[model samples]
Target: MTNDLLGRHRAVLPDWLALYYEEPLELTHGEGRHVWDAQGNRYLDFFGGILTTMTAHALPEVTKAVSEQAGRIIHSSTLYLNRPMVELAERIAQLSGIPDARVFFTTSGTEANDTALLLATAYRRSNTILAMRNSYHGRSFSAVGITGNSGWSPTSLSPLQTLYVHGGVRTRGPFASLSDEAYIAACVEDLRDLLGHTRAPAALIAEPVQGVGGFTAPPDGLYAAFREVLHERGILWIADEVQTGWGRTGEHFWGWQAHGRNGPPDIMTFAKGIGNGMSIGGVVARSEIMNCLDSNSISTFGGTQITMAAGLANLNYLLEHDLQGNARRVGGLLIERLRAVAAQVPAVREVRGRGLMIGIEITKPGTDEADPRTAAAVLEAAREGGLLIGKGGGHNTSSLRVAPPLSLNVAEAEEGAAILENALRSVR
Candidate 1:
């Protein structure tokens, strides 16, 4: 049975397709923030499955919800609404503060972004969207195009302007300590200049806080300027909060909230943390904007009964514990400790981000920017040291994105920090 399972896909999964697995572990089961491989080795999961497992791995409430929902109905087309779907959508709407919202659910963040892109297009009836460069939306065609990162997709396939990037490069001041006003001014100017083009834009897409282009939390004032400008030009502002939502960004339930009311977006996309690994993504839009969608068509399994049940359980967990507050507290401790770790190792360029979604920027010996090799090495060393982490930060260099569960404690963060520090020191 094991041989058969391994052989089934060997024909297509070639050695070159081993990017994510350059140092892969055969992790079998996970509980809370810890995972164990088939070999019985334990590792602290600092990456939290790329920020998806919000509550923790196989959390009791979430598992119970899935178990019960599975015994019941798992699929019901959107042609007819189910209780779970209705309740889950309502709960997210209320939590998100986007009332009168008509939810469209998908199975992944990419799909959600695809839906949001289509939604923006339908509402504005325009052919172009202004995308920030070095931004990452998703892996699907449309999502990839709007991702804002060069080399990730064909330049031609990209939205109207990939060159519209601003504040993407860490124009630094640790996001927590930065002057929010100054950061916003700089980003807003670049956005205005981008929109100054003769071509009309249907929408302007952004990550309230970028996840893939390193975990960057730009100034708070950016979104409002973009929103106001986009609205004045009759363009929608799409907030891709897949990584920042679900209490990962501290007191703010979503990245938009991190920006405050001043930067509230018109439409927001969420997925990673919503279902806690249930593979569900959602879109929330103002009722007026949704009016333009000819969305009578159905998705056979989008927000299925089981998916919604799981979503509700995740929602309950978030509210019951106020995980957002926990993220802020734990994230602060992580930043402080991580900075100290960097201070000990000169190769660490900087520590960036807010909440649990953070990154450690590394530099080569005497060279600036992160070192992709060092990044990969540190990732391997960390894993070897019993921790799980991820790498991104599109420069020639590499940075580790540390997105632990909101439920993570100061002690766990300290342990993860120790592992990371050891990993950084290992390169020598």
Candidate 2:
């Protein structure tokens, strides 16, 4: 009955529910990099559903696969075997570069993370999992538990059982700096202290480039150290690639690789855009961990007929189109444009990130204003100008997150960057 009412009021949000409002524009349809509003106005989708729609809307390849797969078999109960499921898992393992990695599918990024937590606990039996402060893992119970934010405290802290290393995502502090090797050492020490003092060590979970936590990407060796530490304690490492996986990053398909980790995680999870907005989530565990799970088990959802086909289509499209190379090429253009913008914009402090994931830190005049208000203004200004971008960070300062389709071309990059430049000039 509740769902029926929601279905009836498709575009309406209840007043009692907290909502985020920018200006006003209704989405009509989309092609590659453009979206049409209700009134037929077009907007450049730089944000791309907060970095979820990697292949853009309605690609021929993805749609065709979905159509064919749907006709044959949309879904089967977990009790049944399906080719799409096996193929998806097999591709993820081969693509992930982890020897003999295996996958378990879920419905969302958070669900994948939750499954990673379970797999970690079952294999390592460690009591604690470590994540970065202000990191956005997911909103679900266990996913939110590992998330290093006060928002979920008093709610999940008592039962969730997770530890946070360092108080900031952008910098290793109670220490200091980005682009520093010492910060990595400090974080490792912090993890050691937390583990030694707590005696609860199961897994270390992190986003290679923290999307919501100020868009910070720590040193390349950060994961390697964590992997080493966890292994020493008979614990496992988990990489939550919910946002950074696939070809979005450009140079590599997954964020863990960008950091130059020596080995693979015991469990790695994926969701967003694995099927180009289709309802698919997955966890790729090392063979040892995966083998321990009961073979008869399954990753099931009640209504899941369509997701399988959509996921296969999305994966095929990514492979055929060479979106990974596109990410690198256009991502390079974006970085150069951002650096140019920083040279001009006084409020802009630093522009950091790799591949398609980028962030601009807005600092206070004297103290380097990371003003959230300013960030919000930029976001709204961009929206009003028909460029869709989003913000991530713990502070009030705006930490801009730019993740577009992996297939975005150089022309789109120029248009998006130019629009952003004009918006910056308009902002106070």
Candidate 3:
């Protein structure tokens, strides 16, 4: 059955739409932290559909809200007052930390970021943009234009004049050997130099933690320093929080808070966890930037009743249960355990990230060269051992990404870590 379905999928889907494993497992159903493949094989879900499952699988509150909202009205084109949309927007705006915030909903992170680009360009009257090295915004044409990772970015054509900045990844770069303070200084200097060569950019868009760049992050306060420079030039700061938002990073409610010295970003884009499994994405900005558009615009399916209902319920459950605290506690232990395991493995180049968004970079034994084969082998082995993880990196996709549900408990953390350890050993 799985083989037949795979054939059908290959025939129908674009070849560029990649799937996990050599033989991809068809996940049919899920419960809290666990999912069953089409053939009845159960695996502990650590990736959570690329970290989209925020609370847990089949969370009752979100499920109830979605079901109830669907029963009444699933969608109404953004022509009328949407109570759920308004409520969710109010909550997100208040939580966004931007003064006089306005929220615009989209169907995906790509759309959210595209909207942000539109706002920034229109407001600032420039198509020039600054994005960090090893950063990924989204997959849309506009979003892809700003992406800096060569592996994920398939084209050089872009609507925006994008300047790739330094300091998104701190592990392997010209300034990787520097201390945190020196690295930040070097990046700031680099940004200053880059700005000298180009027209003033409309905005500098960055992910607080570079999600597709193997969960890599600049040192704390790096962005704050850059923000100082950008602010001086009246350039906007946009944080792409698609994967790092909603307390996944633990210490901060928003990933940008790690660089909070300059207050919130001028604009923020989010998706992939806000509505749990529901498709909900949005952009938040001060009204000055958000209201820059002079013409009428609406995302037909954005802020629909069902998705907003799920988002509201999911956000409520996340805050009520303090999932951020859970992410901190459990993810702290999990990273420690994985670090211990990695210390014994030469292929494990580095273990990094905050909270549940951890990454294990795979390299050739005793060398810094990325080992994508070993990473792929470990992924396959882990799946065989009843664990599901993800892989991403700027260097040939050689990093193991471990982002469990924020509600992950200690026992599951331990279990996943043990399985990952065995998988690493098998690959070695």
Could you tell me how far off, in angstroms, the CA of residue 32 lies in candidate 1 after the best superposition?
0.8
Model 2 worst lDDT run, 10 consecutive residues: 15-24
Cα RMSDs, all models: 2.9, 3.4, 0.6
Q: TM-score: which candidate is best?
A: 3
Q: Taking the tens digit of each residue's C-alpha lDDT, what string does model 1 give over 22-102? A: 535666899989988777989999887788888889999999999998898788788885888889888877777675776
lDDT of 3 by residue, 44-117 (tens): 99999999997899998999998899899999979999999999999999999999999999999999999999
lDDT per model, in order? 0.78, 0.75, 0.95
The positional error of residue 265 in candidate 3, measured at the CA in angstroms, is 0.4
lDDT of 3 at 231: 94
lDDT of each residue in 277-362, candidate 2, tens digit only: 77777788878887775655665572255776677778887888888888888898898998898788887777887778888777
For model 2, the stretches where C-alpha displacement exceeds 4 angstroms are 1-20, 151-154, 167-172, 177-179, 293-296, 302-305
Q: In terms of lDDT, which candidate is stronger, 2 or 3?
A: 3
Total colliding residue pairs, candidate 1: 1
